[model samples]
Target chain A: MTRKREFTNWIFGRELRDSRELEERPDEERAKPYVITPLGTRVRRVLFCGLVSQKNADESMTRVTVTDGTGNFYISAFNSDFGMQAKAMVDALEINDQVLVMGRVSSYQNEGKTYFNVNPEIAIKVDSVSMDYWRMKTLHIARRKIYAIRMARNRPGSTATDVKAAGYSDLEAESAMKAMEKYPDYDLQEFESAIAAQIQPAAKEEHKSSKDFILQYIQANDTDGRGCRYEDLLAASQNASISQNELDDLLNSLGSDGEIFEVSLKRYKVI
Target chain B: MSDQVKRLKISELVPGTQNVDILVSIVSLQRKELKNERGESVYYYGILGDDTGTISFTAWIFPPTVRIGDVVEIKKASVREYKGINRVYIDAGSEVIMHPGESMDVRRSYSQLKIKDLSTAQPYVTVEGRVSSVREKELERDGKKTMMYYGDLDDDTGKIRISSFDKPLKEGSFIRMEGAKVSEYNGRLRMTLGSRTEVTEIKPSFQVGERLYDIHDISSPLGGVTVNGFIVSLGPKSGLVMRCSACNNRLDDIHCPDHPEAPVAYDLFAYFTLDDGTGSIQCTGGKAALLGHLGFTPEEYTPENKTISRRLVSSRLQEKLLGRAVVIEGDVTRNQSGTSVRISSLNYVDTDFMKKLEARMGADFQ
Candidate 1:
């Protein structure tokens, strides 16, 4: 039988980082390995949107840390044939660039804990509209899974058929059953609280002040005509209690308003 | 007699199971006549279902009174694998007993969907719509004659073609139908209703209108749908093209081989990709969809002009369409390669969609 294309799961960084169980496909050389999250979803590939908070690039490798509103996702691309496209996409990106990425999940174990990273296949700079769309879609899917799990938990003796009869999809039914069996002691409250917190309104006034401070810092810090380095701006914003995600949004808003532009990767100039 | 037989659900009818007893409702039934070594014989074959699932069953001796939707208990039946599918066979030792007071709830695996949601990947569907524009014809196959009804079904969402075998639908009648098989041909979807399909006439509750959809929700081929998106990429083959005047077939050479004596006509063929943030689709258009937008007239775009080149037309299309948001009404189709939309009508959107989107989605997050 021909292997079907693995589904690229649309999920947030918080849920993805919570995956603990890894399943190895039978074909050691040909098959792609995957991990089972606490939600009981088998994730081989993932599609997400986040801000580029950190980047380390060299001749052979490129690693970047991307942060959605909830948590951080680590992406690594190499110079090999499989990684060339991803590396080139990251090479063109600067700090605080919002991007959309689709990639296979790669994981490692250290100190009795598993750490997951993305081996990117495709990455592109996206607009705020696309980012918002991703967030909405991911939230909808997550809520559906959570509902299925809760239904199964309430009816402990229920089977997948019972869940399906309640109008959930087959994938959701199976995952809910698996989650019930695998993570019996897992805290459902924590997941619900996190999702509820996501619904809160963003801090608008605080954002305006941070945007102002960043603009002033860049205007005063272009000492040698190369403009201010992103690292310096990041440090200055951190001192003022601003987060990487907020800085990303501020820089993007500034660029859209024609207040600043990037002279090179990780270097910005006030226009 | 019942104590010795093992009762099981239809889903548990595994291959090579013996003395298998099951209580199921007849979902569908068809009679087959065959001339074997023992002379002419008749057998009933169809699908049986319970609350768990459904299974195909063949019986050499079937109860004469059993009909579709009748509940019957079969005892001492044998299950065997045939053509890689598990089937229940009721032979000489089997007994089918009917209990008049009992009724079983049949299992339905298909989802109730709108006409716009139908896809080839989904094998079965349950839908409700008003039947209209019915055409009846007699079709003969393998020395047997049957009546075939072809028509269009419309709900509030959209319209799709429905083909029924032997069963006739009244024009302008509202009905709810289940187990209609979905298939695609000539880049459009058609629902095939056969013996397995159950139909019920219903009172019309809603009015049908033009349906606009998001790109992400369009997973099937549909006719007459509208979408709002931005033209993101232009295809390489887009621009001016030559066609045979007599047949309108696209021509690569100066004159057409099929109509060498006929004149050649210059036409506009533009192709591009449309993205709406939710999803994206490749789109193709012809002279009717593009000529007015490209500022071209039939009299001016003739072969007589020496300075006018394909490059000019290509550049003109890019300048006017690339990254521009528009409302496009078209037929969306799917082939082996991927899904695409053939443009029937196109117009620029004057509204700032971001402002509209902010107004629509802002309340939830805020």
Candidate 2:
């Protein structure tokens, strides 16, 4: 049907993985080509939007590095399969121009380490509206995938179809399934924070302010350096932007980091 | 949520089954009076279906409260093979209970309903289908002449004829019709729109590209099929045209033959030949579709504003869409000159318009 696959995610370049390990594995069974990230994402394809920082072409192959908010992704267009696209990339595209690229993940092993890159199928020079639209769309998709992965993990018996029936798209469900199968005991808080920061930078900024307020309020209220009462601290922390639950987590972490100490029962003192 | 024996779907019923219980929607029912072992017996035989599948059934004892569209639980039923198909039978000793507080979710069932699932025995049904053709017919009944509009409606599953007595429909429109009268004609099901039916036009909620058929292989009228091809050339009628204001007919000059002193209105059209390497077909669009194809707003290039010339619009359309790989959806009507599509929607595949259009329509794409 000449159906071109649609990839709707703008993943950070840092979360990409080298597909060298899977390529090296010797198995008779056919496996779908996907790159596994540290946060346990199976990258079948990605909708990447960024600025063209550098372009390198040698005869039939052209390679370009694109810089996003977090990092840069290496993009390549080969000759035999993507002859016209490779030529266009080399001759037409210039550095510093924003482009949107949909591509499959590729990688190579260098000495002992592996690096990840992309083999673009659809690439277009875009203006600001197109670039920003793709960026926000990808951010939402990535965030949804993060949440779906966590929910699928908690429900082990659920299948990809089950996850899909629970409001996730087929691609996201399959990604979650692959994420679970590839990465075991996957810690998600770091990825959660990364996605949270990307989708809504304003919310993250607000959260940072609440963290600072908690620390300052504790320091100011601890008179005689004898620590502050729990009830009094809660009252003061409630005045800040964060919720009661978030305030509790901040207080526990502050104590664990030796920034605060328990002077008495239900009381805290800054260290 | 309990560890209980779940209700069986209609497809799970097989021959020689005993003491089986299932939840099924009564798709149809009819009472027949027969004389045999019992001098005269009244029994109900009909079809039942669930989300999984459908099966015909005969009930020796029919309950008064059990009606069509009621999701009911039938107990103590046995399965019997009838003409190579399974039929579940509930004897006179069995019970037909109208289980309260148990019905399929209204919204879920409506979205999942399809034209192929419809039967003549169904009293009322709701379905979404594409209008393949609309034709007017005149007939005499009881010494009175009446005009009727017939439309061929199709979904992915199959096609059915819709008889609209007073309602007018466009030749190629996607619509969701509710409470259509179901009837059988020539062994196939047909739906009639009477006083109680209502239809609302809807855009496609799913993608159509499953098999990009070779244009050469399609020999007959094809509906709801997706094809990918390149816009090879623009047709002669690809530019602007003037229509008679009073008659809505194409005018060769400033005046129409029907109304000599009538005013004229301007309109835009875009038709092009699409070649997919296998073959080529002519694709045509209406004014709205043409404007969307050209990426122009109606307000910018209306008849009142002569800033943009007809030749300019035509040349711009050709320059923008020609030679580009595109995906189109609609029916292909065949004649002596082969097939042509009345394009319902067209996409250039890798453009900004796809993102905007698909997102606004809430279409599910991957």
Candidate 3:
């Protein structure tokens, strides 16, 4: 007996896909669930990273919303094989935590509307470095998929059988045929722009030192027992190539931690 | 005289189209001499396509004008249903002219390939993996040995050996490399990093240090990863282990097997079973990693006035580690009972991250 074919792992973009159509090959009775994208990808498994926008979990089910710079992904972990893992994540995970989630494709319908969702298998907290890597990595994967979709259309015959015979796998060939049929003449500019915006190797956030840099700046400026003024702090940080937004977040985090305190309005001193 | 030709994508061709023009690449060509009732010749068939799709055409009694892979404009072509699909037949009086200055651009599918799927066909490829080990070897030639580094590169898919003659790598680092060349080495594909290759440390999407897996993810041997579980029990040779000073290999009750004459040094080790409810595995950690996160050293286990510390240490070590929720980073080696972890670093799962939550809710987190 031959082994069953594996479902294709998907690279996601900002585009939302909920086709409300369930498709399976007649030859394979085992159901491999997937959703068709306008770009012609049949998504099965996906890996994504984002900040936790929302999380809610009960004994039977858990749901989470994760948002990257481009868009948001809705994840549901029901009490099946994925229940205990989801419960652990939801009970321990907090809002605003940067998370990486890998899951399978899932969809539902409500009020005659189709909604695509991810059933998270592994959801874990990730650091800034991991977040940067995810963007860089995901961008590359998305680019390759888009290129493959274009290649399929460019090939001679341009049919499912033609693409398969042209050395592409059956999954890819099938997806290409489905995409051309489902979304005729769809523009890829929006998805391309989204990839471009997030794909620049995560800008190499030297953020490891962003917080420490602010604290040292505050210390150096506080002299004669007088606290450092906000203007002086901003000027020094800006000169050091630190953005105003990052400096502000660090200042606020430091202030809350009691590492520094406001002696007066817009003035702070190390405690 | 030349006239402006209409343009239709090859994918848009269908049955029942008359006098319609299309832009397509001549992917194939076949010229044949055929005999009709009066013995006639013909330019038989060819396949044409553009970025959108492809279709076939037959032009009988007309000269073959389009070359394979040449983007052409087919003017006055009519479509007909053939084999349940569409086919465009270019008869006489239709013209097939080269669409000048268009490239037959094709893309090869080798970009961003994972380490496990790497093959020798792809000379240059980009891959991402966690560096499990880096053992620098000396490439010898004419009594000179230039340094070369090789070790295991692992991802979620599988693990492979990676070697670089020019670049140095560290163990337990997540990295992405571009322009790395693949070459067959000892029946397996090995990636070589030359001067043109770029190697940069990558932040992995998952936690770099903590990789908690249940009994399922562990089947065979694995590279460096972390697993969180509870300590079930300990081995008889768990604590107070001696090592050969010359090689640091753990010694038996007599002496090191390889270094019999070498002096020995004493160290503490804890070997026990760790179960995460999915299954269990034997885990090993040293006294330092275990006691460090426990916020104490073996000195705390010793009695005052220079008393003995051997028997007392066993009871206290279990109190520190066994049945406790801890994260252990190590190499997973499989055996009959299942998988076991040879701990490299161990720590109690600290809640330092909870500070981020509290720090946001209020200004005075202290």
- lDDT by residue for model 3 over B104-138, one digit each (tens)? 64221225775434644334677788887689977
DockQ value for model 1: 0.10
Pick the winner on TM-score between candidates 1 and 3. Answer: 1
Off by over 4 Å in 2: A1-12, A17-32, A38-42, A79-82, A156-165, A199-271, B1-145, B149-163, B166-191, B194-366
Residues B147-196 of candidate 2: C-alpha lDDT, one tens digit per residue: 78898887765466788876887788988888676776443457788776
Better of 1 and 2 by TM-score: 1
What lDDT tens digits, residue by residue, belong to model 1 across residues B74-122? 9999988764456899998899999776788887755678787776544
Q: Model 1, A72: alpha-carbon shift in Å?
A: 1.7
Stretches > 4 Å off in candidate 3: A1-10, A13-21, A25-32, A79-82, A159-178, A201-271, B1-366
What is the full ranking by TM-score, best candidate first? 1, 2, 3
DockQ of 3: 0.02
Q: A109-214, model 1: which lDDT tens digit per residue?
A: 8877788889886666766555555665576567667878898999879899998889777777888887888777667677654543332234223335777768
Poorest 10 consecutive residues by lDDT, candidate 2 chain A: A17-26
Residue B36 of model 1, lDDT score = 66
Q: Which candidate is the best by DockQ?
A: 1
Residue B180 displacement (Å), model 2: 2.2
Interface root mean square deviation per prediction: 6.6, 10.6, 13.5
